[model samples]
Target: MNDKNHKVYLHKKKYTRDKMKDYTFLLPAGLFLTVFLVYPIFYNIILSFRDINIGNLIQGEQPFIGFENYQTVLSDPLFRTALTNSIIFTLATIIFSTSIGFAFALFFNKKFPGHKWMRSILLIAWMTPIIIIGTVFSWMLSGDNGIINELFISLGVMSEPIYWLTDTDTALLGTIIANVWISIPFSMVILLSGLQGLPTGIYEAAKIDGATRFQQFRHITLPLMKPTILVLLMLGVIFTFKVFDLIYIMTAGGPADATQVIPFLAYQLSFGMYRFGEGAALSNISFLIIGAIAVLYLYLIRKEEVM
Candidate 1:
């Protein structure tokens, strides 16, 4: 070969080796996704179309039932209750938690004594395990000896102890209260970070122009914080949707299935009743819902960028 051709060949060989090395680094992640994420997803989708339950689950060959499982899940009354509870749980968690979190973010933004300590205290609920939070809240809302009932009665807010978790009307609300509390710290952290990143000079300029706090927030702060709020809302929705441990530990979808959200309902179908196909179908629906949230998040972000 000519000297220039040999040089070019060496360069190409080095480039190929570099590319190979880069791909080698990604091999582990590729395998992990294929095994743990991709395979399970495809298998679950296949399961959702089958007529397999626990007894026939391991046989690996089941009768194809097309959309029968989906139809059954949709037609089931229990599924309707679970869907309603899921919606209520998601909406209430988003509204209350984000509002409280925003309030906390605003409060902690100001310089004050124990500002760091007070802010850190808000994260305790989030750091605590879900089961622990569920158990503690369960105890705190018990009809017989709950601290809340006792305090309410002592303060004349109520004449007697209220069955917060055991009553059909109140069971979902009990779970919501706990979820809101659990969710707030995360939202606070997100909002606080967003607040901290805002240009202080903008707020000062707004103030100099005679803008009130509400006006500053409405115009300056909110427009800047849209992305952060989007993330907070999406994450809150997803985390709230996946809440099975908390609800299960506290109420186990009890009080006439009042607290039975989709995840817990899926668990009931799969583990409790051994209806793996139906459970898989329900879980697929849940996955699609979460995926929809992600799509919506992307759409909003792109729209905002265009604006």
Candidate 2:
């Protein structure tokens, strides 16, 4: 070959080798997703369209029933209740957690003695295992001789102990309280980062213009933290919606299904009652809802980048 042609050929070969090396580095991650994430997702979707119960899981033909499983799940009143409860639980937890977290973030943003240690100490609740938190909250909220009841009685706030976990009226509320407590630390850290990222110059300018602290926060802080707030809320919704361990440890979806959410309902159907098809369908429903939120989150991220 001519010298120039040989040189061009060698350059192309080097580029191809480099590209191949990059792809080779991605093999482990690709295999992991395909085997664990992608395969399970597709399997669940296919299973949702089948009549796969314990009776037919092993030998008998697991017939493809198309949308029958979805139909059954959609038609169930308990499914509706579970959906409603999921919404309530997710929304309430996000609202309370974000609010309290923002307050904590603001408080800690100011430099003070022992502030760093205090902030780190608060994260212990968040870093602790969810199961442990659930168990602790369960004990604290117990009706008979629980610390909460004892404290309330001593304070003359109540003459009798409230069955926080066993009574249907208060069961969901009890779970929400636990979840909010667990979520606060995450929210606080996220908002604290956002707060610290704000331009100090803008606040100084606002102060020079006779702006009050509340006014500066409303005009300068909120607008600057919009992206952070949006991302935090989206993540909170995604995580809180799929919560099962806390519910399982705290109430077990008891007190007449008062605390039943989608994840717990799916667990009950599949493992507890052996209704695998319905369970898969319920799971797919949850997946779709979360997927939509994930899509929205991506869109916002792309928009921010474009801006």
Candidate 3:
């Protein structure tokens, strides 16, 4: 070959080899996701279409019932209730957690005495396992001799103890409160990072412009923190929507299904009730809902990047 052609061939060969090495590095993670994540998702989709309850779950080649499972899940009154509760629970937790977390993030962003220590102390709630947090909250919210009740009585807020988990009126609200506490630290950390990353120059300029603290936050801080807030809300909704451990530990979807969200109901159907198809169907529905939200979030992020 000519000198130039030979050099070009060698360059192409080296490029191919380097690309192969890069693929090799990704192979393990790709295989792991295919095996553990992709396979199960596809398998669950297939399972949802089959008539495979406990009776015939072990048997091979179960009958394909098509949309029967979906119809059953969609038509159920409990499913409707669970859907509503899930929406309410997810929205409530995200709103309260993000608001409280944003406040805390702003507080800690300023360097003050013991600021780091206080921030670390607040993270304890998020660091603790959700089940443990739920258990502690369960005890605290107990109608009899609970600290919450004791505090309320002491302050004359109520003459009697409020049954948080046992009452239909307060069961979902109780779970929302627990979830908000658990979620706040994560939101705070994200927002805090965003806040710390903001340009001091802008804030100084705003101060020089005679802007008040609230005016600076509303005009400068919020606009700069929009991306971080979007990411936090997206992640918070996805995580909170699938919350099962906390609810199971606390109320078990009790008090007349007051706190029966979709994830818990899916568990009840698949394992508790042994209705595999229905459970799979319910899970698939939730997956679609989350999937749509994730797609929208990604699109928004891409748009922002383009901008």
Candidate 4:
């Protein structure tokens, strides 16, 4: 009995020591996330409940108004418009980006001359800074000297050059186009990686069974790439929903708040209009929208794993 008790005590000590060593590896990352991610989230939550505008921001005597800020933000007409625009923008970007990216991936997946070179060239869009892309596209879409308007006119699509940025009707579309261009390369790269990682043995077996290329892609390729596709779509939705720089530089959310999405709206509320609490509320609302999508994605992934 004494020998058995001694063995148990020694085993417990060794297990604890091993657990502590494993925890040490995670300490630095846990601390970094707490400081940068957790602190900001909690700070934002606190600010959302208070009236901390430009005038009182410096004085720091913000009165806690509970849900008034959120109520005001939700009730605003511009909030409705921003919500509509955000959905349209996010959906449009995701659909076009993913579709085009998949098409590009399929084409490049085949062994062909200059395929590697072409793929690298396309990636330049992703590697370039967002601000630069926005700025350059702004010039290209200009009413007078813009290449897009000029080409459209030359092609008889329109009789005259159109103002892409200053017009309310076209501002959001212009921004989405720019966003799609940026998003495509990212999706392409991800899908290409998935494509390249597919089992060669399975494909060869399918070929031996006399499966057509389309049949193989529909039955095998898509099933295998489901995880990657879901992740890419989720990333696209998240990225497009929180888009800021393109809208800010290209249209500044407007001819009349036409291009304002939630993040830019939050900026307008907090910094532009000096309503910090309302801005924080909108920002938190944006987080909720993204969070819902993320939750749904996790649920799908869990179900897939279970199946």
Q: Across residues 166-236, which tens digit of lDDT does each residue of candidate 1 receive?
A: 99989999999999999899999999999999999998898899999999999999999999999999988
TM-score of each: 0.96, 0.97, 0.95, 0.92
The stretch of ten residues in a row with the least summed lDDT in candidate 1 is 52-61
RMSD of 3: 1.5
Residue-level lDDT tens digits of model 3 in 27-81: 9999999999999999999999998878887766579999999999999999999
Clashes of each: 0, 0, 0, 0
Output the TM-score of candidate 4. 0.92
Q: In model 4, which runs have C-alpha deviations exceeding 4 angstroms? A: 1-22, 208-210
Where does model 3 exceed 4 Å of error?
Answer: 2-4, 302-307
Ranking, TM-score, top scorer first: 2, 1, 3, 4
lDDT of 4: 0.93
For model 3, what is the C-alpha lDDT against the true structure?
0.94
Model 3, C-alpha of 12: deviation from truth (Å): 2.5
| Candidate 2 displacement at residue 194 in angstroms | 1.0
| Candidate models: Cα lDDT each | 0.93, 0.95, 0.94, 0.93
